[model samples]
Target: MRSPRRGNAFEQAEAAFKAATKKNEPMPKAPVTPPAGKEMVSLRLDRDVLAHFQDDGPGWQARINAALRAAAGLDPA
Candidate 1:
Protein backbone atom coordinates (compact mmCIF):
# COMPACT_ATOMS: atom_id res chain seq x y z
CA MET A 1 0.00 0.00 0.00
CA ARG A 2 1.16 3.58 -0.65
CA SER A 3 2.10 5.70 2.36
CA PRO A 4 -0.31 8.50 3.20
CA ARG A 5 0.64 12.23 3.47
CA ARG A 6 0.79 13.31 7.16
CA GLY A 7 0.80 16.71 9.01
CA ASN A 8 2.40 19.60 7.08
CA ALA A 9 3.40 17.44 4.06
CA PHE A 10 -0.07 17.86 2.42
CA GLU A 11 -0.03 21.60 3.18
CA GLN A 12 3.50 21.95 1.72
CA ALA A 13 2.47 20.04 -1.44
CA GLU A 14 -0.61 22.26 -1.84
CA ALA A 15 1.55 25.42 -1.43
CA ALA A 16 4.02 24.17 -4.05
CA PHE A 17 1.19 23.29 -6.48
CA LYS A 18 -0.41 26.73 -5.98
CA ALA A 19 2.97 28.50 -6.50
CA ALA A 20 3.54 26.59 -9.78
CA THR A 21 -0.01 27.23 -11.03
CA LYS A 22 -0.10 30.99 -10.18
CA LYS A 23 -0.18 33.33 -13.19
CA ASN A 24 2.42 36.09 -13.66
CA GLU A 25 0.56 39.17 -14.84
CA PRO A 26 2.23 42.23 -16.40
CA MET A 27 1.60 45.76 -14.99
CA PRO A 28 -1.01 47.73 -16.96
CA LYS A 29 0.20 50.75 -18.90
CA ALA A 30 -1.12 54.29 -18.19
CA PRO A 31 -3.13 56.00 -20.95
CA VAL A 32 -1.25 58.61 -22.99
CA THR A 33 -2.77 62.12 -23.13
CA PRO A 34 -1.78 64.83 -25.64
CA PRO A 35 0.06 67.82 -24.15
CA ALA A 36 -1.96 70.41 -26.12
CA GLY A 37 -5.40 68.80 -25.54
CA LYS A 38 -5.40 67.40 -29.11
CA GLU A 39 -5.52 63.71 -29.84
CA MET A 40 -3.21 62.39 -32.55
CA VAL A 41 -5.01 60.47 -35.30
CA SER A 42 -4.48 59.01 -38.75
CA LEU A 43 -6.49 60.76 -41.47
CA ARG A 44 -6.72 59.41 -45.02
CA LEU A 45 -7.10 62.45 -47.26
CA ASP A 46 -7.42 62.28 -51.05
CA ARG A 47 -4.22 63.23 -52.94
CA ASP A 48 -5.73 66.36 -54.58
CA VAL A 49 -7.30 67.48 -51.26
CA LEU A 50 -3.99 67.00 -49.42
CA ALA A 51 -2.13 68.88 -52.19
CA HIS A 52 -4.53 71.81 -51.90
CA PHE A 53 -3.73 72.15 -48.17
CA GLN A 54 0.04 71.60 -48.68
CA ASP A 55 0.32 74.33 -51.32
CA ASP A 56 -0.04 76.95 -48.54
CA GLY A 57 3.31 75.74 -47.06
CA PRO A 58 4.40 75.22 -43.37
CA GLY A 59 1.11 75.97 -41.56
CA TRP A 60 -0.95 73.64 -43.74
CA GLN A 61 -1.99 71.44 -40.83
CA ALA A 62 -3.27 74.44 -38.83
CA ARG A 63 -5.07 75.72 -41.95
CA ILE A 64 -6.75 72.35 -42.43
CA ASN A 65 -7.84 72.34 -38.77
CA ALA A 66 -9.26 75.85 -39.13
CA ALA A 67 -11.14 74.91 -42.31
CA LEU A 68 -12.55 71.78 -40.62
CA ARG A 69 -13.68 73.75 -37.56
CA ALA A 70 -15.36 76.38 -39.78
CA ALA A 71 -17.09 73.68 -41.81
CA ALA A 72 -18.37 72.06 -38.59
CA GLY A 73 -19.59 75.47 -37.36
CA LEU A 74 -17.32 75.23 -34.30
CA ASP A 75 -15.18 78.15 -33.03
CA PRO A 76 -11.66 78.33 -34.62
CA ALA A 77 -8.99 76.38 -32.78
Candidate 2:
Protein backbone atom coordinates (compact mmCIF):
# COMPACT_ATOMS: atom_id res chain seq x y z
CA MET A 1 0.00 0.00 0.00
CA ARG A 2 1.18 3.58 -0.61
CA SER A 3 2.23 5.66 2.39
CA PRO A 4 0.31 8.81 3.34
CA ARG A 5 1.45 12.14 1.89
CA ARG A 6 3.29 14.37 4.37
CA GLY A 7 4.20 18.10 4.24
CA ASN A 8 3.62 18.14 0.46
CA ALA A 9 2.41 21.66 -0.35
CA PHE A 10 1.76 20.88 -4.07
CA GLU A 11 -0.18 17.71 -3.24
CA GLN A 12 -2.12 19.59 -0.53
CA ALA A 13 -2.96 22.42 -3.00
CA GLU A 14 -4.11 19.95 -5.66
CA ALA A 15 -6.32 18.21 -3.11
CA ALA A 16 -7.68 21.58 -1.95
CA PHE A 17 -8.48 22.63 -5.50
CA LYS A 18 -10.28 19.38 -6.17
CA ALA A 19 -12.25 19.75 -2.96
CA ALA A 20 -13.20 23.37 -3.73
CA THR A 21 -14.25 22.69 -7.33
CA LYS A 22 -17.92 22.06 -7.97
CA LYS A 23 -19.00 18.44 -8.23
CA ASN A 24 -21.49 17.21 -10.83
CA GLU A 25 -25.04 17.68 -9.49
CA PRO A 26 -28.11 15.96 -10.85
CA MET A 27 -30.04 18.06 -13.39
CA PRO A 28 -33.25 19.47 -12.00
CA LYS A 29 -36.49 17.94 -13.25
CA ALA A 30 -38.90 20.11 -15.24
CA PRO A 31 -41.66 21.82 -13.28
CA VAL A 32 -44.76 19.70 -13.00
CA THR A 33 -48.15 20.93 -14.18
CA PRO A 34 -50.65 21.61 -11.42
CA PRO A 35 -53.62 19.27 -10.92
CA ALA A 36 -55.87 22.37 -10.99
CA GLY A 37 -54.59 22.79 -14.59
CA LYS A 38 -53.34 26.31 -13.96
CA GLU A 39 -50.17 27.08 -15.88
CA MET A 40 -47.63 29.51 -14.50
CA VAL A 41 -47.63 32.78 -16.43
CA SER A 42 -46.38 36.33 -16.36
CA LEU A 43 -48.89 39.14 -16.86
CA ARG A 44 -48.39 42.87 -16.57
CA LEU A 45 -51.08 45.02 -14.96
CA ASP A 46 -51.41 48.73 -14.12
CA ARG A 47 -50.36 49.66 -10.57
CA ASP A 48 -53.85 50.86 -9.59
CA VAL A 49 -55.51 47.79 -11.03
CA LEU A 50 -53.04 45.60 -9.19
CA ALA A 51 -53.53 47.57 -5.98
CA HIS A 52 -57.33 47.30 -6.28
CA PHE A 53 -57.11 43.52 -6.40
CA GLN A 54 -54.42 43.39 -3.74
CA ASP A 55 -56.21 45.72 -1.30
CA ASP A 56 -58.08 42.80 0.23
CA GLY A 57 -54.78 40.89 0.38
CA PRO A 58 -54.49 37.08 0.37
CA GLY A 59 -56.24 35.32 -2.53
CA TRP A 60 -55.53 38.46 -4.57
CA GLN A 61 -54.40 36.16 -7.34
CA ALA A 62 -57.74 34.35 -7.20
CA ARG A 63 -59.55 37.70 -7.33
CA ILE A 64 -57.52 38.73 -10.36
CA ASN A 65 -58.29 35.38 -12.02
CA ALA A 66 -62.00 35.77 -11.27
CA ALA A 67 -62.03 39.31 -12.63
CA LEU A 68 -60.21 38.25 -15.77
CA ARG A 69 -62.62 35.34 -16.28
CA ALA A 70 -65.56 37.68 -15.83
CA ALA A 71 -64.12 40.19 -18.30
CA ALA A 72 -63.51 37.40 -20.78
CA GLY A 73 -67.14 36.28 -20.33
CA LEU A 74 -65.92 32.98 -18.94
CA ASP A 75 -67.22 31.33 -15.77
CA PRO A 76 -65.32 32.26 -12.58
CA ALA A 77 -62.48 29.88 -11.93
What is the lDDT of every predicted structure here? 0.87, 0.88
Misplaced by over 4 Å in model 1 are 1-35
The prediction achieving the highest TM-score against the true structure is 2
TM-score of 2: 0.52
The clash count for each model shown is 0, 0
lDDT tens digits, residue span 29-63, model 1: 99977668677889999999999999979989889
Alpha carbon deviation, residue 61, candidate 2 (Å) = 0.3
lDDT string, candidate 2, 7-40, tens digits: 5999888889999995889899999776586878
